[model samples]
Target: MGSLIDRVGIVTGSGRGIGKAIAEAMLHEGAKVVISDMNEELVKQTADELKQKGGQVLGLVCNVTVTESIEKMVETVVNSWGRIDILVNNAGITRDALFMRMTEEQWQAVIDTNLSSAFKVTKPVVKVMSKQREGRIINIASTSGVHGNFGQANYAAAKAGLVGFTKTIALEYASRNITCNAVAPGFIDTAMTQALSQDVVTKILDKVPLGRMGTPDDIAKAVLFFAGPGAYVTGQVLEVNGGLYT
Candidate 1:
């Protein structure tokens, strides 16, 4: 519930889905938000739509897998906003296959997109945030990372890596007053999940004690907490999963 007036934030992969929800929530809190995605059209479209929320918005095309692309995105944000106050590493993908059937390409693709991108994106942001001595970093993780999933070895491993990375960042940046945390969402009804077969979706939802899937807003609110009033919290993994795991 803390006001983020004048704060500047960046939500990567924020053209749609949970990432877009996070950007909207930050805008609602009065933060200037940069919506970054690999898709130029989608990012521009989302930025235009979010302007109705009455906050400054910037749309940037960024391929998270490439270091040069990430550097440019960070440069643009800093040039426009002066400093970055919040960063949400929400760019991720899933290449699912049983371990026995998983290919090297699939494994590396998920790792590079989901796990490696964090290191690439955050490296430059950390420099600016450290100089300012104030910042928030929230990684979008998944329950599959916390509790292994059936056909998502690559995804689960990448998310699990995020959990560790979050802690390490918190420890490293504590002295500089930067907080790092992870939000592990469970069975959120995103376009990704909606694409699953009905039976598969039903089985996943059956495990949720809430008896329904979580919404993008559910995940967004959690990100907001860490960015705002939850500033004292660091090195924590908050499961926004409605009794699914806890």
Candidate 2:
């Protein structure tokens, strides 16, 4: 039997990229997953695709920056599945600029989506999990958060905030049998990194001893460890960085 057979999970920003990979991994392990994203069409498409693979999937349109939208999604999930066994706070965006050049809007946007959304989404989910006495929460953080990046002050701050949030949740909710952890992915080959100039990409790759960009599946594998076999683990940030020490 799969490790997460019959479990219900929510993966935010799951319409594509790393978030999609996490959802796919959970579904492969027999979890009923919720494909939550702001893009309605993408959500529907991804859910349909996963369902075709025999996954028990639900598609929900969620604006992670809006608490009302978040609450509605949580309500719908609970109404359909009766309980939430896992949540992956994977919704994030990068507004790349040096600190001096970054605007308030860019910083606020990243902070709201990446860090504050976790606070909003987890509150209600935690209430549900507290009653069930078990749940797993994995936040998608970044290596930029750990070591900082030149053009990602806003993104790095938000992710660093997420790392703190994960640890705090882990400590506060352990008594309720809920585990919270953060997965810090480094240089994953997603559309985000693909947007970079070749010169920048080559410079970044030169720092990696592995000499290659990490794939979304590499991050997914680390997430799966927390969701499945790593039951005794919590409050930790696992860096899946392809041996690239910043």
Candidate 3:
């Protein structure tokens, strides 16, 4: 759909993984994307590769945990494009450990990156969006957050918090034409999951009814549903799992 044609959108952690997939999907449907990530080298590489496809993209170095970092990043985009239409809070990290063994720093880091980072970036973007009275904000959460898992206290907590935040913001801005939603993904083949042993991966999938892991494209498509579908869907969590939670 060219509904997003020539529009400016930003996806965090876009150097790779699901974030990259979302940006690519938007571009396929005709949207100019700003790739945001903390990794400068990876950002440039992804930007260059997308440009190879004739995608209009810009690399933005951002650390979502820091207010100034997000401030400067948003300012740069507004200065360049003059309008920010959609934002996907896909940047996150994990420090999996038992509750008894989890360090304060580990817990704090996960919360900052996964949860607070959404706030830090969304606050500014929402201001601009509210002014226009139309916008899309999609936050990437996890199935692990919905159904808590062992050794992932921090990750689960932060992701669950994001779902709550999404719902609240959606309600607060319902009349302003600003839609906020969350996408909870199950297993996806990415660098993070690849780090797990084959046995662990298999064990995890054994519980899924679909008998297979999901892909980044699976999550990306769900995100696109919220981005340009032009429906009044909001404050909802679309679980892109293999029917695991069902």
Best model number under lDDT: 2
Ranking by lDDT: 2, 1, 3
User: In model 2, what are the clashing residue pairs, if there are any?
Assistant: none
Model 2 / residue 64 / CA error / Å: 0.6
Per-residue C-alpha lDDT of model 1 across residues 64-125, encoded as one tens digit per residue: 99999999999999888899999999998888899999999999999999999999999999
lDDT tens readout by residue for model 3, 1-246 = 476887789999999999999999999989989999999998999999999999999898998899999999999998988888899999988888899999999999999999999999999999999998888999999998899988889999999999999999999988989999999999888887888889989888988899998989999999988998476799999999999882
Judged by whole-model lDDT over C-alpha atoms, candidate 2 comes out at: 0.93
Judge candidate 1 at residue 117 and give its lDDT. Answer: 96
What lDDT tens digits, residue by residue, belong to model 2 across residues 19-44? 99999999999999999999999999
The lDDT values for all models are: 0.93, 0.93, 0.92
Which pairs clash in the backbone of model 1? none
Question: How do the predictions measure up, each by TM-score?
Answer: 0.97, 0.98, 0.97
Model 1 alpha-carbon drift over 4 Å, by segment: none
Give the root-mean-square deviation of each candidate in angstroms: 1.2, 0.9, 1.1
Give candidate 2 misplaced runs (Cα > 4 Å): none
| Per-residue error (Å), model 2, residue 159 | 0.7
What is the Cα-based lDDT of residue 122 in candidate 3?
Answer: 96
